[model samples]
Target: MADLSTDIALDDERIVRALEEDIIFGRLAPGARLTEDSLLSRFPVTRHFVRQALVQLEQMGIVVRERNKGATVRSLDPEEVQQIYAVRELVQRQAALLIPLPAPQALVDQLLAIHKEHGEHIESGYLRGVHETNDRFHLTLFGACGNKYLVQTIELYMRYSLPVRANSMADRAALDISHSQHRLMIEMLQGRDNWVLAQLCVDHLQPSKRRYIDLVGH
Candidate 1:
């Protein structure tokens, strides 16, 4: 393969990250073809590394590979979205149930820090920062789930879902409302009531998904 970069600036991880980000942000739409040659000739990575990243995404249920049809990103429908969240909540609820409550106050503290930072971003009208910071909040909470696979799965889901969230939260007023609701979710987790925490998680998803369905539906 001809070197795609003069200085070999494109590494395997960098290429994968770039592709993943594009997919996450919906620049690469679902069902869009991803050819190895086009990418390899364009990027400096070997076919092996590209395949590896694609396989990882497949495991996370975001990318699909068909024998003859080729590989493309998954197109998630409303029912599929509901199923993903329902299963996620089930697993996370159990994870929360088992995560010794007091032992992870540090997670709550991290969410607090993220919340404070997000508030500033909100005021500045940089809505994307709020979305990223919100990821940090949930990342902290769920990262300590003690279930490595579950945590990883959730992160992958979040990456792909972010564009959906960012689009809906484009309104500053709605972003502010969302921030307040997320803050309440963090507080709810402090109680050690796994059930309530699970419900809070489900409820938190409602506002954004509702906006997406409404906005995108029309």
Candidate 2:
């Protein structure tokens, strides 16, 4: 497991992102405690920055802070998982419908580039890289919907889903399934099949949702 000592001289955003990466990559397991003293020691930052980072992480649904406990990586129960994925499915379906098909050559090229990088990361077994690149691919694709609020909501929901994804992110089979869907999404965009693309978008969210719920006894 990678430790804080390795993260030297990082700013607040970097700290938050690094912590989030650790959680998603399983370096910081769900329910892992996050203390100000521990975080301050890891990065050259003040308590304010550490607190701010924790607060941001909480808002992102990656961490939970209690009255007695400072902060811990967040975990979702079966019901919460189902509710979130249901909303995600709806938002993603709408986003897919909004994407203009044949998907502007520029958008297609951009998605292709992201997809290629995602594949490379998966091939190298770089879990953090895979997570990051996969996020980029989806953000870029969803952003094409041209609805700022809609895109923002989707991004928020995605963050909320990250911990759930962590339950299966390490599995090679899961990664393959995810990347395959990504490729199909790109192909659907190219073909201008909005309904199929929308259905694929909804279906794509199922595996992770099911995997997480199964782990928690859904």
Candidate 3:
């Protein structure tokens, strides 16, 4: 597996994004070694590209590398996961409240579409798809909050969250329940009740915190 080509050029940013998406989707497991040989074998990229990608993830606390240990996915205990989720809720909730709602309500409609798709994916028992779609739905909403600072902050937490979300998606019940929350959040957003929406966002986040602790507590 070490003879792969590096014909396709991948810049540092694209390389990082590719790895992040793959890792978040569990295509790369925690503690899985990301060797130069393995990456070369899998994709047509240079060591420079691969290192740049991994270095970005390391900075984000998503991956860690060592001389002897190589590069392995970063593992977070439950407390860390809880802290990440708490930050996500705080930043995103405030973002939703602070950002102006743009005209046409297109974003709200899009969120509904995502919820519908997630429900269908769950009903079909495509749990992985459900989690992915749900994540996109929430992130899109959070980004639309129109505050660059909040979006940037919450995105940092999501860097940690993506992997945990994927792991949690393994449980079909949990995936479905998580999808169910999307509607309530959208409803709150639609009502323009920033205050109530803030509280609801916190409430929704607590279950994730508790569940993560229960499943993989520190």
Candidate 4:
């Protein structure tokens, strides 16, 4: 029974991740209804699993559930986008600033490897791969801050702004810019200028924030 329960839990998690990617990649547009019937037809899971997945998404800030409305992809207004991005910028910059100058060779090598995978995904036009690796690269970079709480805050804001950030994932030019920026970040890590690295981290977040605000109109 324990093995069976574990398998069910893993299956539920898989559903949650797939739905998350759908929302993040714009396949599931903001405000689209996530009906249980629809989800059941899509995944070979029970209604209970669908409900659990939706609850997890809600906790992640990727979905909103209302009494009569069921679940919908969470949409942020311009003001909300601005606020979330502001926090994200602050936390991410602070995390970068905390990293030891001339980052350890191990850290540099790790980031390089992730960056390489990110570039390959972009070249192959694999949107899922690109999104996953891009996230992995950023999280790994920020994790070096050596402050778990700060890194957790940075990650939280990243989750909150997913709808706003999704636009960039589908834009070719934006992806290229991100790819270049990741390479620059890796190079910056090998240097001793913490301020420059910190500023770069803040600057890296602007395009998506600006683009989202413009699209939604303040």
Per-residue CA lDDT of model 1 for 1-218, tens digit only, reads: 67655323445457656666666555777667888877788766678777776776666556788898777877656666666666666665665565555545777777888999999988886655766787787767776667888777777767555535645555777777778977886777666676776676767667766665665455
lDDT measured at residue 148 in model 1 versus the true structure, 0 to 100: 81
Query: Which tens-of-lDDT digit does each residue in 41-160 have in candidate 4?
Result: 999988999998899999999999999889999998988988898898889988999999899999999999999999899888899899889889999999999999998898888889
| Each prediction's whole-model lDDT (CA) | 0.68, 0.89, 0.73, 0.91
- For candidate 3, the lDDT comes to 0.73
Model 3 alpha-carbon miss at residue 164, Å: 2.1
Higher-ranked by lDDT: 1 or 2: 2
Per-residue lDDT of candidate 2, residues 1-218 (tens digit): 76554443356688889998899988998789999999999988888789988988999899999998889999888899999998999999999999998888899899999999999998999988898898899989999999999999999999999988887778999999999999999999998689999999999899988888888783
What's model 1's overall lDDT? 0.68
Q: Could you arrange the candidates by TM-score from highest to lowest?
A: 4, 2, 3, 1
The list of candidate 2 runs beyond 4 A from truth reads 1-10
Candidate 2 lDDT (Cα, whole model)? 0.89
TM-score, per-candidate, Cα-based: 0.69, 0.90, 0.76, 0.95
- For model 1 the TM-score comes to 0.69
Find the candidate with the highest TM-score and give its number. 4
Name the runs in model 4 displaced over 4 angstroms: none
